[model samples]
Target: MPEQGMVIRGGAVVTAHEIKEADIWISDGKIVRIAKDTLPKATGTTVFEEVDASGMYLLPGFIAMPTPSLYKRKEGQTYIEVMREWVRSGCTSFVDVLQLEPWMSRPQLEYQQTRHFNSPLDYAWHLGMEAAQLEGRTVARYRELGFSSFHVTIRSPEEISSIQWETLWQLSASKQTIVHLHIQNDASVKQEQRDLIRQLWLDATKYWKVRTVIADSSAAFASREFDPFLHIFRLPAETTDRAVRYMYQRFYDSCPVASPLQEVRIDCRRRWCPPEMLLCLLVRLASTNIAKAIGLYPQKGSLTPGADADIVFLKKENWLTKYDLSTILNFSETHLPTSVMSNGKWMYRNAQFHLSIGMGRRIFDTKPNVYVI
Candidate 1:
């Protein structure tokens, strides 16, 4: 009854505890069936339409919360390229971490529209708090355009007191939408600043649901601002290979912050987080099962029958499947995700979906294998 092809038999099926072997069948853009130790043969199945995913890690797609970072280079990535990576890297959904700046209103809508076509991944956005939306029609316009959440940056330059902070909390709580803030970086502010931040957090919860998410932690590491329990030793810049091995225990396959930070994100900005650190964040997220606490539904973080089959199958940079995503996000090194799926479409298959990647393949697909590579 569905439109897409089926995927059968992956060796490593992601379970609650570990990866196990199983047969998975997808239809209607979702996982229609999954079982172990057996296969159901059928007639009239489309030829070459099913993938025998043996030995492959059939992973649930990743969900990325945005970090006020935008790609600065215009020609660097086209819409298709961005989406391709989202899927190829096994990311089915992403939230744009935005700074509520001047263009936050108009561009955000344009961005959502453009990105929807660019990637097969589901995209959500969090608005960075600035008073600017109050003066303009930005809020009314963008809110109607589907900007459902607002992330207020608490680290303000002004002298913010506890009572005033409580007022800000009340204001956001009354809005009744998702309210989250950035709290991770402390090197830039004094202890008094940290205390004010804490006060605001407490009061914010009094009125709002108290949602929080940090986009990355490497910046916090540089600032020595990671929470004590969740802190990781800074790898030496000089010896990455040696350092990576040593830091293994300090890291999980995924490294989430202490449970407290799950309720509140400390760092709100997405500046200078290279690929390696991104991988660290994902590993932490996967390890702690933090998404379960914050997610909207059950069976998330999965690609199982009856789960929201938002799946992403990516081309691993190190060609290491069935392993954690540490290799890509740890060294700040850039690698292509190469494929992406949202609910279940091939957003990016062989390579990047951006214009650059698409144009090259279109012009060169006719070439022989010898010259193509």
Candidate 2:
């Protein structure tokens, strides 16, 4: 039997379908029961820890799908510290994208080694693919090693040749692997050159016929709809009101996936979105929608019984006001979670971290949906 159990009482539990007041019971690192107010007594003597969640919104923890290499530890900062920052912001799961290196393998052991095992979070790696890595049985090898996705950054049309597109299509059709594409403006390249690359993407999508994600984009392309292809905008760590307006507009109009990494800046300070719309976007759309887009739904994105206990607790008092669109968009940017639980372990509670070194685990899709070409 597991050593600990917990009961969170009197909070509004938010699930994908709806939100309702309930008490949650968790044991052995999984949610065991969910009831209106309290649970029935157990047969054995088990002292479960109790947390009063009255007047709070209990939500599934945020899943951050950050651009590879966006986070680099500042001078003298440790890995645990960096991860703690994520927990502080309510993220319990994240995707770690790494640049392709000659010695890299499907699982990318070197990158995995950097994860703090004692941290109270989970992560998965997506290896960035360049030209050389796309050749031969590379995609097959990645599949064999249990990778369900690959990352590719396109800066020029030359990068998406017929052969490259064919390789990507074959992999997606046969192996169900997703391709995360980052389309960005290259300062070194001329405008016409960048335009040509954008044109290639618009044209290649019709042929690829695979699940592709526009991982990051500029304002010009943020609102453009790419049907059958999901768009996940990467918000600048410090951005303006105009950028926030464009991002939120794109989110509602285009139905793109959102991540916690797209933080906004006001008065020289970085913060999360306004409380009024934060949960709807960050938890519902950003976490749940993105998980489904990547084919890791229900398992990673939900808070139902038997789902992984990756949850975030938010104070109700901080959010109860109605705000206009600009107030909703331009309000402070940091949404600090009151408490965070990942895989049934308390990662952060009452603004304090309860993590050790090397506690975080790797997450992967065990039964990914196969996409037919």
Candidate 3:
């Protein structure tokens, strides 16, 4: 990781904006300025290292949802899945979101000793505290073991114990805490349950309230067309009574396995939304009269001034239309980057991953989607 690195002559200067031909100056892994015109005094003769990003979409590196098994992902096994593959997908940071019982695995111990040693990208972890285990002695032990935050996931029917909620609230109030709850499947419950959860939502804010992230209730929330194969979580409020009647009327029009409505209930997908789509949605919602601040929406998601300098340089014109803003509109689903940086440090480039060195054991030569143990 260089102390100062600048990207010279990039297309659309910063990937988040829609434009062409721009240059950005970065210092200490942070982008300080962008110019569509020319540099100012002492700029061209500066001693900082620079890279040419001509003809590419210089976007922000991706941040993935958390997972449980990462603490033990590569420990005691012939590894198959490498973190590098995910980095090649233009992702720079991944959060480990699991209800770990304040316990340490061999991998966690290994990672603790070697995380900053270096290899691919930058990363962090979010401590998860599930409702089912909130009251247990094991959870208390783990909570005391110095975790960063607590998440009360509502993936199932939530409990109504004020005792547990108070404990979590206390933890969050200490400023060492962040909170996130699963709302995607909340719509599947009865109306009373929905009202109860929303009522309890006020308690979630009683904490210090640092970072909170939420996701789509289902695939239909984002899909342009209601493809049953790409959705899940049916809510009474989502469809109107008229649509219900119409749906029943069409029930006899389809076969069993091929039915469209049946298909919408199984689309359990994640991280498929393009970075631009996510950004545009955030910008749109955050700038509205009502300003729908969705979860811990970031102020900026790229190597822009006054924000984190996690940047991704991608070429969309190969499959997408080159030299046109069409790449901006239609490239959301496909335009992953060839290079990615986190904190101004190169994490991915040319199909190679740069994971933190000594972080894990690399026993498998090929990539496997599953990490056994």
Q: Which candidate is the best by lDDT?
A: 2
Q: Which tens-of-lDDT digit does each residue in 195-287 have in candidate 3? A: 455435433443323233333233223334222221122222233222223323343332111111111121113333344333322222211
Model 3 global lDDT (CA atoms, 0 to 1): 0.42
The regions of model 1 sitting more than 4 angstroms off are 1-4, 37-48, 66-68, 71-88, 98-117, 131-145, 156-176, 183-188, 203-209, 214-300, 312-341, 348-373
Give me the runs in candidate 2 sitting further than 4 Å from their true place. Answer: 1-3, 43-48, 66-77, 103-119, 216-225, 229-254, 261-278, 321-334, 366-373
Q: Model 1 Cα displacement at 190 (Å)?
A: 3.5
Off by over 4 Å in 3: 1-4, 14-21, 40-46, 66-68, 75-81, 102-119, 132-146, 153-158, 163-176, 182-300, 306-308, 322-333, 351-373
Error of 3 at 365 (Å): 35
- TM-score attained by model 1: 0.56
Q: Is candidate 1 or candidate 2 better by TM-score?
A: 2
Worst ten-residue run, lDDT, model 3?
A: 364-373
**Better candidate by lDDT, 2 or 3:** 2
Q: Assess the local accuracy of residue 365 in candidate 2 as a C-alpha lDDT between 0 and 100.
A: 66
**Better candidate by lDDT, 1 or 2:** 2
The 0-to-1 C-alpha lDDT of every candidate, in the order given, reads 0.41, 0.62, 0.42
Candidate numbers, best lDDT first, in rank order: 2, 3, 1
lDDT of 2 by residue, 1-373 (tens): 4256888898988764356789988887778778885554343655578888998888887676654453344333565666777778777777666566777654565555464344446776676776446643777777776677777766667877734667766777778777666655468767787667655665575556656665444432444444434334344544334444444555544444444534543331334455434445445455676566566566677787887888888777755442322333322233456888888888888978886556667776633333110
Estimate TM-scores for all models.
0.56, 0.78, 0.56
